[model samples]
Target: MLVGEHMTSPVITVEPHATVSQARKLMQDHDIRHLPVIEHARLIGIVARSDLNWPSAAKVPPDAMPVAEVMSGNVIAVTPRTTIENAASLMLANKIGALPVVDEEEHVVGILTAADILSVFLEVMGVGSGARRIEIRLPDRPGALAPAVQCIGSLGVNIVSVVSAREQDGWRSLVLRLATDDLEPVLTALADLGVEVVSTGEGDD
Candidate 1:
């Protein structure tokens, strides 16, 4: 997936001259942690919650200090077309929570944060999505997974996600999320194919 698909756009920004108090209030009212600072329609810096709390560096009252004083000037940003995976890598390498989406002209377009990435994680997990999830223990052989998958595919069930992991018992397990509300048919199909069903749960569990 791409950053543009998930990034929060119509970027909410604070002016470079805006006071720390204003930035804090804006973040609180909007329930956002980071605010991109803009000056003359240009991306200048970004101020985060910790920046407002670190008084030793700014050494001024929140109401008296400008956002530019506490903002991170060396902002790490991404383009709209960047993939979500690459953007996440940048965040991990930089140890930062947010990345501003910038245009070619250095104009701030949107913001990508850990919260946005988390939604994708939940989607991959199929949590609270009313999808049927199944786990099967496959033999440690090459053709094991293919037949198990073919069983579900023959039933015309759409697989939402699949992950394979080695268990402590020296067996490889395949976890699958299927885009279907009813588990009975998928379960029966897997059972007919001699696949083991580990756990099952409905939405909002």
Candidate 2:
């Protein structure tokens, strides 16, 4: 759940003095969208693919443009110890897809991206055909999970995901995503079976 666990390390970087053409080539060769700008081992800023594109009809020379000219100096970053939730929040707040992981000295160590978070979340939530996602809270007990799942199975609901976590003593909150459209009936059935259905919602339709 930590940023370090999902961050991409050994990140490719472009020097501030590097020409825009050079940066573009690097991005193309690597098939990446963003590049962290560095100078003398210090994180300076970031340059995106959109920053490099110029109208083909323009007569400006590529050498006249440098990464420092168009790079976004207001780069948002996170520390290695930061949690995935916090990192994702920062990205969401800043409206950015990627976040550079920096050390105490602002030296780039890695990159955390939306793709990474989505991948991990999907794995934790389980991904498959008819994959459904639901969120609820359940009581902690030895046979809590089996009966809860059985209730759904009885309703013909295919459970594609089931994530449970213990928070605030004895009561456990669960986020269940199932691969079915008829969630209301299943939820009512769960409630009827004495399973607390705190909240329910549908998945990617």
Candidate 3:
């Protein structure tokens, strides 16, 4: 899915001149960890809760300092059209948990976070609540799926998800997720139809 579909829009931001205390309050009130820093309606930096923690030997209270002093000026951003996978890669490469979503003029529109990507991915994979998943190969011709799904339906098995991709031997491997913990019945039904079961496994929450 695209960033815009899942990004938190109308992001809560902090002004450059805003005190660190104010930033902290915003984070606490919103239950957010990252805060985009804006100056004159332009994104200037980003601040994280970890970035403002002060040591005991520090001369100044972190909260008393201007947010601009501790915020990271070299912020990374992604456009709303970016894909969730691509956004996740950027977060990994930058060693950050969140990225500011900016428009053509560099104005912040929304924010995407690692948590958001994780939630979205788990929902798509049908594994958010700890369902068992399996991957199997099927013939790449018409009528291949009709019989397999029909067999699954016969058992009242819920097909949580299915992803197919090209494979060797003119077959497609479909990764399927199910709400039921027991997989034997579904496996047996597919086997009865001469379906090749590649792999089966359980998933953790």
CA lDDT, every model vs. true structure: 0.86, 0.83, 0.89
- Per lDDT, the best of the predicted structures is 3
- TM-score ranking, best first: 1, 3, 2
Please provide, for model 3 over 68-134, each residue's C-alpha lDDT reduced to its tens digit, 9 standing for 90 to 100. 9999999999999999999999999889999999998989999999999988977887877566788
TM-score of 1: 0.83
Better of 1 and 3 by lDDT: 3
Per-residue lDDT of candidate 2, residues 1-205 (tens digit)? 8988899998999999898899989989998889999998889999888889887885766777778988999898888999999988998888888898899999999988889999878777776545656677777778878888988887777777788845658888988878776677877777787777666555445
How should the candidates be ordered by lDDT, best one leading?
3, 1, 2
lDDT of 1: 0.86
Tens digits of per-residue lDDT for model 1, 1-205: 8999999998789999999899999999999999999998889899999888854665577898898988999999999999999998999999999999999998999999999999977776766666677777878777878887888888888887887855656578767888876879888887888888877764355
Candidate 3: clashing pairs of residues = none
Give the worst 10-residue stretch by lDDT in candidate 3. 196-205
RMSD value for candidate 3: 4.2
At residue 67, give the lDDT of candidate 3.
Answer: 94
